[model samples]
Every structure is written in C-alpha cells, then in structure tokens.
Target: MRKMARHKDVSPEHLPYRRCVGVVLLNAENLVFVGSRTEGPEHTDSARPWQMPQGGIDDGEEPYPAALRELYEETNVRSVELLAEARDWFTYDLPPELVGHAWKGKYRGQTQKWFALRFTGTDSEIDIHHPAGGAHPPEFKAWRWERLERLPELIVPFKRAVYHRVVQEFAHLVG
Candidate 1:
C-alpha cells in the first residue's frame, strides 16, 4: 500500500473508507462559502470549478468533528454550529491523476460526510491562513459568498453531484 500524505498518520483501514467531511456554511445574506483549488491545473471543460471547505476524517474522529475541523482548516472560519449532517455519506471518486502517488493502488477515491452550518458570526471570522491546519492550504487565492443553487454551475464537474445534494438538503436556506 502507498503511504498517504502528512495530514493524518494512521493505517488505511483505520480511516473511514476514504471518508471525508465538508461544511456548507450559510450566512445571513443567504450566500454560501465557495472556494477554488489553488494548486492543481485548471479543468478545461468544467462548468463550475470551485469547491467547498472539505477534508478527510482522521482515524477515530467522528464525522461531525471532522466537518468542523475541515471547515476551519480550509477557510479559517470557525465558531459556527453544526445544524445538520447528511443521513448518509456522499461519495465521489477522484480522477486517477488527482490521487496522490501514495494512494494510487490502495484507494479508489474519497467518501465524504457532508454537513450544513449557519454562520453565527461575521466575515471577519474567516481566516484563510493555515486553512486545513496546514495540511491543505487555500487552493483558491480568493473566495466569495454566492447563491447556493448557483454553486453547481461554478464547481468542478466531479463535484457537481455532491453540490446538487447539498443544495437539495439546504434548499430551505436558499432565498
């Protein structure tokens, strides 16, 4: 098996089957936080190429905690309450090239546990520095709050399905 990255130091099986968590943070303006990948080559034909703050769940960590952790790590935003979590996990496979060399043979892709949160604070709460706790820094140099329904049109194609589910689950928050 290939060794994973420095983010977590646990055996493969102990992890949640490529498990990850993400937060769809909703602000009072009804816009959701969306960010783009800063490091990878841009997709040529993607409809929307941004992604929400998300990351893998560490061994023995619950999905909720992971979701909160990922949100803080990816966006530097914190202190939001977890309002709800998907009853089931939403999964997506990484294109072969997206997988790191260490995870190539042993893992198929990622299985994400998604959550929805309401921002109790202001924009000053977001801290892009050391997002992902230094594991994965901000990919996009910029971020903005946008209508949640419009996200699927702005995210990478591979993530559009999950974005759809997010919108459906949080449709009540849409203006």
Candidate 2:
C-alpha cells in the first residue's frame, strides 16, 4: 500500500483545494518530460524535486485550456497533441509544514485535472528558461526526458500518489 503523508492539523481541513492542471508530456521516443524545480519559497524537502508541468487554473478557465496554458508557461512548448485525460480529478495534501506557506495558505492542497499530451515538435522547441519571454520566472532550472513509470519516485513524496495514478491512467498510451 502507498504510504501517504498524514496531515495532523485540523485547520487544513477547512481550507479548500486549489483547482489545477497537470500535464504528462510525452515525446515520440516514449519518454516523459520531467523538470527539476528551482529552490523557492514553496520548495519541499524532496531530494530530487522533479515534476511534470503543472499550475493552477485561472478563474473561468476550463481544464483543457488550462492544461495547455500551463504546459506552455512551464515548458515553452506549444506543439502538442492531446492524447488522453484522467477519468477523474486527483487530490494531494500539502505536508503539515507547507499547509500555511505554499500557495499563500489559500488551500489545503491541489485538486488536479491531469492530461497526457504528445509532443509534436522537435527538441529545439523545448525551453524552460525564459518561458513566456521570462514574464514568468522559470519554475524549473533543468529538465530531461524520463520513463513514465519512474515519475512517482522522482516527484515529491506528498504528490507521489497522484503521480502514480496518472502513470497508471496514461501508461498504455506511451511506449
């Protein structure tokens, strides 16, 4: 069984979940895109600190467009074909330490709508630095292609369960 982080604080229960979108971007070689997040105010204690592209949805934004916008915002890649979407939204709680720090204490965690997208462009089109003309500082400092099944281990422990479910949901579509 998966051991998930237990939130011991009662206050977090009263906080709502942040609505977000997660992208599993696959290249033609069947590898998934994983980014090494930069150390920041919202940084977790994960040793690897790697994750797929993800971000919160704007007000009145639909999930599909939100997913695309996040992917482009984080990866600077716009040439992608929609492959699949998770059957249901998945949620993960912030560790107790992060409950009040991350996302400005706006939510307990995130409720994400996951999408699997196929990269339709060449590697030259991928750029993490200066994403959105550096309008948004890069979330990731470095990135690489990785196996889909390895994501759970590569991500922050608190979010591993969601990553596992996403891999299970989209594994068949990749090599």
Candidate 3:
C-alpha cells in the first residue's frame, strides 16, 4: 500500500482514472437523451455543457447495474431496457484545469463503461426537476431527446471524443 501511495503521488499522469459508467438512452424516435448541466458559478463561460446520464461505479457494483442506477439517479426515468453495450470501455481525460479539481481530486479523468438503453415509457415518466432515484439533487437542470449523431457536439469539449466513439459504435442501433 505504501508503494502504491508513492506511485499515486508521483505525477498527474500516474494518477488512475476514476471508474465510471455512461449511458445513451434512445427512444423509438431514435433520439438520444441529453441533459443540460447545472454548472457551478465558475463555469459561467462553459460553451457546451450538455451530457448523457453518467456516474461513478460504486465498489462491488458491475457496469450494467451502475449504468441503470446512474440513469435513474440522474433522470428519474426507469422505464428502459438494455439495447446494447459498447464493445469496449471508453476513457477521457479532464483538462489540466480540471485534473486535480474533479472527483475531489481523486482522479485524473474517467474510464467508462458505456451502455445503450431503449426507453419503454412515456415522456411524463422523466422527472429532471427532482430526481427520485438519488439521495442527492438531480445532476441535470433540464433534459431533452436529441439526434444520436449530434452527441459529439453536445457534450463538454473534453468528452467529445468519447461521444464520437459512442455514436459510431451505436450507429446501427440509432436508426
């Protein structure tokens, strides 16, 4: 453990990526779920702050369950069925400005397991105003269903590459 701690403090590049799960919720209309972030005061100049539902992977939790839990926690929408899973996990790095500030400075970025889900319920089921599935407040201030191809353009810049990969990997399922 001492050796690991020493390596951990070595440098930012040596820091591990946070384990996470990301989901793309698709409706019959083939639209992807997107939510506008409730940005902090410091992010007033952020350009694209929208993102899909996502969250950390709790210890002992598998990616699929984590994905479902995160989706519900962030959106309060449970009427979904797994449509597909990505062939591989995707990762993204936080910019230098965010590296030691995100996740309470525990991680350099995130290594994510991505899932695609199909919504089986009505729009009224989504309650972004007050998420019932989580102990905390909703992560999103507003929500919308958007074109799958536009995902790469909707998220924060650092996350765009992963979105592009997801869009490409799940292209066949979208339409």
Q: Highest TM-score: which candidate?
A: 2
For residues 42-127, write the lDDT of model 3, one tens digit per residue: 13235687889988999999999999988888888889999999999899987766555556667878899899999999999898
Cα lDDT tens digits, model 1, 67-138, are 887787778777687677787777765544444432433444567888889888888877665664566556
Pick by TM-score: 2 or 3, better one: 2
Question: Per-residue lDDT of 1-175 in model 2, one digit per residue for the tens?
Answer: 2243334444798999999999999999889999999976446654868999999999999999999999888888999999999999999998877776677767889999999999999988888998865677899989999999999999888899999999999989875
Span of ten consecutive residues with least summed lDDT in model 2 = 1-10
Let me know the TM-score candidate 2 reaches against the reference structure: 0.92
Residue pair clashes in candidate 1: 38-139, 48-154, 48-155, 48-156, 49-154, 49-155, 73-131, 73-132, 74-132, 76-127
Better of 1 and 3 by TM-score: 3
How close to the true structure is residue 10 of candidate 1, measured as C-alpha lDDT?
34
Q: Clashes in candidate 2: how many? A: 0
Off by over 4 Å in 1: 1-17, 41-47, 96-105, 130-136
lDDT of 2: 0.88
lDDT of each: 0.70, 0.88, 0.82
For all predicted structures, in order, the TM-scores are 0.77, 0.92, 0.89
The TM-score measured for candidate 1 stands at: 0.77
Model 1 gets an lDDT of 0.70
Given candidate 3, what's the lDDT at residue 52? 92
Instruction: Quote the lDDT for 133 in model 3.
Output: 45
